[model samples]
Target: MMSTATAIQERSLLGLKHLSREDILAILDRASYWEQQSEKLVPILNKKFAVNMFFENSTRTRFSFEMAQKRLGVQVMNFTAAASSVEKGESIYDTVRTLESMGVDAGVVRLKPSGVLQELAQRVRIPLINAGDGNNEHPTQALLDLYTMRKVFGELQGLTVSIIGDIKHSRVARSNLWALQKLGAKVQFCAPSVMSAPELAEHAPYVSMEEALKADVVMMLRVQLERHSGGLFQSSEEYREQYGLTEERAASLLGHTIIMHPAPVNRNVEIDDAVVECDRSYIFRQMAHGVPVRMAVMERAMRD
Candidate 1:
């Protein structure tokens, strides 16, 4: 006979590949309960250890993981691009081998290039949660964002969601689209053709920002400076006029559309400052939920 924890333990949430629509709903149901009671709950991960191995510069995602782990009493080993020998010589696989030798348990990782997390998933027997991997996915961020949406609007099905900007270089864009589609939201992309998802992303991306903004939710992602291998556009001014969310455009769609951005936002480049601060905005809530959601991820991993 399986204990409740044992049932969850035998299940591995290694990838979206393993999750059904029902599985995601169950995770969300659990996350919502945790979000409400997290402050009252005793630290569960006390003495257990987790590691953060990031290959990028981040504010919300990195610190959120640390806070989440700490809140659960999980000891954390933090490593960034600068602090480690990743600067001089060692490969990522070698770096993980080194960490494994240190007795770290499960780790949450952020890296560049699509499919890198999949590679790491194979390499590490310990559960590896994907933070952000190039323009491929940010699973945890998507989870938090979806939780926010459900809290604000009550349901996702049939609601229009516009994910705007840098889709070609944003893991958030890809992950959000995946989650939104799975939950029955009508998802669309707003970007220059070059910055849009590749042909296989299903929906034909809108070249005109205005066309995509007619959504119940407008989610803007920051441009990925590090991954823009080529200048997607010739000039910032031209880019702003054509595709950027200007004040004029904001006023046009200003009423009830919930505006969101997965930080850090390139203000005036992808979104108008006023819109980001508007009452309709959920940017900060999205950031705030990061801690609880990551806590949920860590808890589930440890239970497994």
Candidate 2:
């Protein structure tokens, strides 16, 4: 009979919504162990090959997954839409099937369309990890973000987390809402009227920027200028004054309150440069935690 962990290995991690609270905790506990030994490479994934198939461009997520794979002794195959046969109009199913034929044991995929990863998972035999799928979810990122919060507060129950900005187009926000709420954290969404989604408001109530900044964790999201059509906000300066985490706003938060952002920040647009480096900011630490959390996920997906 297969153990629970072994059963997890056979399943595709398309979203956090599919995981139980115990499963989420198990991943976090495993991540904590990896965090303690992050500087040392492990052979947990020795002799395995994992392919990275990213249809959308990314910096932090792509590199962190590659680092996690290498640190665990897995051979990395990097694939980009521009360089791959995807340019020749090949389907995602064909691309993944080709990689599988080459003995790729697992894959981390990021696509611009929602639910495509889940569709691909049905056709693929190996475990599929969703890096980010459109405006749907980024499950691993939510895991890392949860890990960061747990590291700081030592618990997630009853804690308040306010996710600010670009909620309509943010996969991070979608993932975090589900994961955080499942772990007993109260989540609130704060965004420009145009950027707020009614669907998310059903999970987390929409709060004003002032109310959101007062939470225990203030997570500012990128404005996602590329994803938006036209005129979401009236002006950059107006948005900053109303919603951005400026130096003054960050300073006003109690010392116990922490500021966070999923990066490639717009500098002064969503968050001020000074606020990102402020004493209460955990923005960079969040990035540091990404490797170990992802390492935990990879280990779980490939465990025998």
Candidates' TM-scores? 0.88, 0.95
Ten-residue stretch with the least lDDT total in model 1: 8-17
- Count: clashes, candidate 1: 0
Off by over 4 Å in 2: 1-10
- Candidate 2 residue-wise lDDT, 1-304, digit = tens: 8755446445568898877888899889999999899367898788899999999999789999999899999989899999988999999899999998889888999999998888788777789999999999999989999999999999999999999999989999998988898899999999878889998777899988889988999999988565655766557777788889998898878779998888878889889988888788888999999999999989887766
lDDT of 1 at 187: 81
Give the range where candidate 2 is weakest over 10 consecutive residues by summed lDDT.
Answer: 3-12
RMSD score of candidate 2 (Å): 2.0
Q: Indicate which candidate wins on TM-score.
A: 2
User: Where does candidate 1 stray beyond 4 Å?
Assistant: 1-18, 38-41, 201-207, 224-234
Q: Write the per-residue lDDT of candidate 1 for residues 1-304, one digit (tens) a residue.
A: 8754445333434345346677677777877767888374457778677888898777678899888888788889888978789889888888987887788777778887677777766666567778787767788888888888988889899888888878777767767776777889888887767776676366534546767778888888787544555766665656667777777877778467888888887777777777678777799989888877777778877753
